[model samples]
Target: MNAISDTGAAGFLARFAAMQGRLPGDSTLRLAAANAFRSLGLPGATRGRRVEAWKYTSLQALGGMSFRAGAATAPAAKGIVFVDGRFQSGTEKNFARFADRADFGELSWPDRDPMAALNTMLAEDGAIFQIPAGIDAGLVHLTHIGTDGASAHPRQTIRLGAGARMTLIETMSGSGCYLHNPVTEAHVADGALLTHIRIQADAPAAFHLATLYVAVAAGGTYDGFTLNTGARLTRTEIHASLNGPGAVAHLNGAQLLSGSQHADFTSVARHAAPKGTSRQTVKNVLAGQSRGVFQGRIEVARGAQGTDGYQMNRALLLSPDAEIDTKPELEIFADDVKCSHGATIGELDAEQIFYLRSRGIPDSEARAMLVRAFLAEALDPVTNDTARELLEDAVARWWEGQAA
Candidate 1:
């Protein structure tokens, strides 16, 4: 099989079909993936509105742009860039926790091309960050910049070895008319702890789609916080699997939408082993004619006793034109497990505003304060004070502009 011949749409379909034969030898999984791709290949007219709970932030409004290959510019910092599914050489840094050549070499799939798997399974070119065993480290920053008129798909993979601890910070910003499709996969080994923070501030003409997948081993911990403030259309998905007993996962996210922009945050947490726990909180502020969506699901497998999970999603509509849709779900097969989910959508509290105004606070300032307070909950879990402060500042700046 000539893998290079599989480029573009036809190439993708052929390669995907070939890879389907080699995947875990699971016919059901192959059919599921094929069906997913077939659904994805439909025309806009046929697809129309999205029926998925997490797809309330529609990408169809962005017109007919599809993911294509292109050249990515030189990154300003230490990170990999993939333009149109091609990898570009980035500057090697001594300070950055880099993935060595051996790391890439070890990722081999028998009877299947790794590169093809990466291209078909992943949506973009991405870098990998690995925290070796016994390495307790500080934050590692990942910055993604998208130039105008180019579509880029980047995929990232991170692995944390036993007893390792680290923080990952991602900042995605771009301008011009383009699409950024990114996917990230993370593995937290036994006794490892990982803190992840993401910031998305793309241009108004940009369409961004991101998915993060995480696997936690026994005694591992995974914590994440995300803030999305830009892009005409953006969707972020986080999926985590608790594969080991005593694993823990926590997720927090906030989206600030204005103008005609749309943002969606969807997450799924699955507990496959005993004594695992997960919690998630999501917040959204919608103004102007913008829209936001939050769909979260927690699943506890049968016989996975001692599993605990909780999820909450809340939205604030600042204008009559603003809209929000939320769906919180739980699928528990274990009778001994505990799982719950809650969702709320409403306007600001009128009584609180009146009380603030009576206290001599200007209406604008009072409103901004209330909004800030509402957003602070998501920022509470950020371990890096600088990152937390930066997020706070960004929220404040956006709210101030809204007030003005």
Candidate 2:
């Protein structure tokens, strides 16, 4: 550990002192969570670069930023909004339709992630809902915003009853060099279905860390996608468990990064029951010395027979200094299972660019077209119309800027 992370308890204690009484959640729980974070200390850039999990990411810039509480703002139109760590007004109208299906709980994962613990310790408010069986909860939108150098921790819990269905869209926007940490837990009961889409478009100097944990019961399905186009540093971590037979989980995402930005997407899919299925597809577009990281792991339990797992990651580097790192791992203990994973890194195909250019398209436009096509393959799995449209629009806007 370097001096930055090795600050031990002093660093955490100082931060806790600055925003101690203002934190959300039960006091006892928050205290325990803070202690947990203090125990692990922070991850420093000098030492973090050597750690297996932090090999490609650095935290030195994070330590240099001084983060305070964010200001509370009113809800945006037609969605639940969280400003800083407080929920905005007017969300009561959607309580019956979307806001009442989740409840807060201690979301403890197998790994002791400091970011999650810190979020739990400081979060003042979060969304919780429990959708009843046979209900179509319609589309629910949640927006999180940060201002200036402020920091915010937003948490959420969602439970879908049997035969229920819901589509959720989460958007993050902010300015300056703020730190935003969000944690989410979702449970899909038997025969239930859920579609979740997250878009991160924070300021060019912001830091974002998001963690999601999901459990799917028998005959249930979970579809999730994340779009990362902003932020100086970001890490999106997802953990999914197929707890019952015939459960399905689909995770797909795209990262469009430029400048000196860095984005990392890590996920783990566990097949605990027989005949479960999991799929992961990720694409990255990097330019201007930007970096992208993808780490995906699929594990089949001892009796998880008839399991099917697939993972694919592709990267397009637009600059000589741009970099992409991908690792796909599979561990199967079952006798009957089909699993495969692949990763590819390259620039735009010269043949495709040539073909488009020969057809009257400008070189820049041809490159943008190729980039759009590359991301489209990863986004094709999203079936929700509204969510898909929103993501497509974001991708289109990013591409337009790139071409310009």
Candidate 3:
């Protein structure tokens, strides 16, 4: 593969080829991923300016950078740290109950060769987290700190044993001039419950691409929420499989962007077994010249009878220059399954603004209040009160900054 300038199709192909070779191994899944990358190819001449239903955010402004491995240092607390895709070890005296392995060999993926596929496609290094059966681990904090002067890739895999429950909090923050491409794979066994909270606060010069893949077993539950408040360009992808009967998944995400920043949230949930259920909600707030995108799809296998799925995406634009694109889809083959999707894009309501002003509230505060109310629908799924409060505070701070 020859290196081409960033603008051409050949350049994109060459980059993909290089990633494939640098990946951990070669597998059928890897080949499929390579094919998908090829299909996406490169952005056209109007790459960022074009309006695509699935791509509301633009990555044109993010310059490419080389990825380098980081040293293995100790983490500050008990949680694990991955800096530039390598594990750093230091323990905060309070750190306890979290599992970490420098090696990916200990992790297991039965449905696919996620390690090889992700490595080849993403060309980044990450870590694995495991929780044993019957353990009610309160909260496992995973932090990605990018100290690398340039871009980096970090991948993670989390496994929860049967009858176990855990809460995972992920914080992405760093100062640098590069992109952060992180992929996380999660497995929840039978009767297990896993809650995931992701907060991203990358620098203005940072570009981010994060992916989460989840598998839920019989009677298992998976709940996730993402708050994207930082970065010049950020995209998060969630792909889940309802692999067993009575499995349930609830996915919610919110993005607050201003200036020239952009964020994209995309997800796909598949029902492979009967009696599975899934619900998805995404809310976005765009201001200045920023852009936001949300794309969600639900698929019911041919034999997946009694499947139930629902999806909704809503966007609020605060400036004429801002843009939003939303797409919600449902593909059901089973006759007994129930699935539906809806999307809405609009500005603040004049009636509500007048109502607030009539009650002596200022315009800026009233707008911020309404925006927070609009977002509550998505934030309600966060099960932890403290975590939820933190998320709300993040949203409030972002809105206050916009108002100022």
Q: Which candidate is the best by TM-score?
A: 2
Error of 2 at 221 (Å): 0.9
TM-score against truth, every candidate: 0.81, 0.91, 0.81
The collision pairs in model 3 are 73-89, 74-89, 74-90, 75-89, 75-90, 76-92, 77-92, 78-95
**Model 3 over residues 1-404: C-alpha lDDT tens digits?**
34345432334345555555555533454567555544443223223333353345544443243333344343464466666565565343223221233233322231233223333454445666667887777776777776544445565677888988888887777776555767677889999999989988777777677767889999899988899998888888788899999899988888999998878888889999999989888888888999888889898999989998989888888899999877788888899988888988999999999999999999988987888888776687787986787788778778778778
How much lDDT does candidate 3 score? 0.71
Candidates ranked, most accurate by lDDT first: 2, 3, 1
For residues 1-404, what per-residue lDDT tens digits would candidate 2 score against the true structure? 11222222354456665666765446676677777766644456323324455556667776555565556574474587777655774453224321232234545541377677777666656676668888988888887777786777777888889989888898888777777888888899999999999999888888888888999999999989999998899999898999999999998899999889999999899999999999899999998899999999999999999999999998999999999989889988998999999999999899999999999999988987888888888688888888889889888877777767
TM-score for candidate 3, please give it: 0.81
Please name the candidate that would achieve the greatest lDDT relative to the true structure.
2
Model 2: runs farther than 4 Å from truth?
A: 1-12, 17-26, 45-51, 92-106
- For residues 1-404, could you state the per-residue lDDT of candidate 1 as single tens digits? 43435333334455456545443333453454444544453213135334454345544444344333445564555454433334544543322212222122122221132122333342323566767897986666677777776656555678888988888777777668666666667789999999888888877788777767789999999988889998888878777899999899987889999998888888889999998999898889999999888888998998779998989988989989998888888898888887888988888899999999999999988887788888887677776886887688878877777877
Task: State residue 126's C-alpha deviation in candidate 2, in Å.
Answer: 1.7
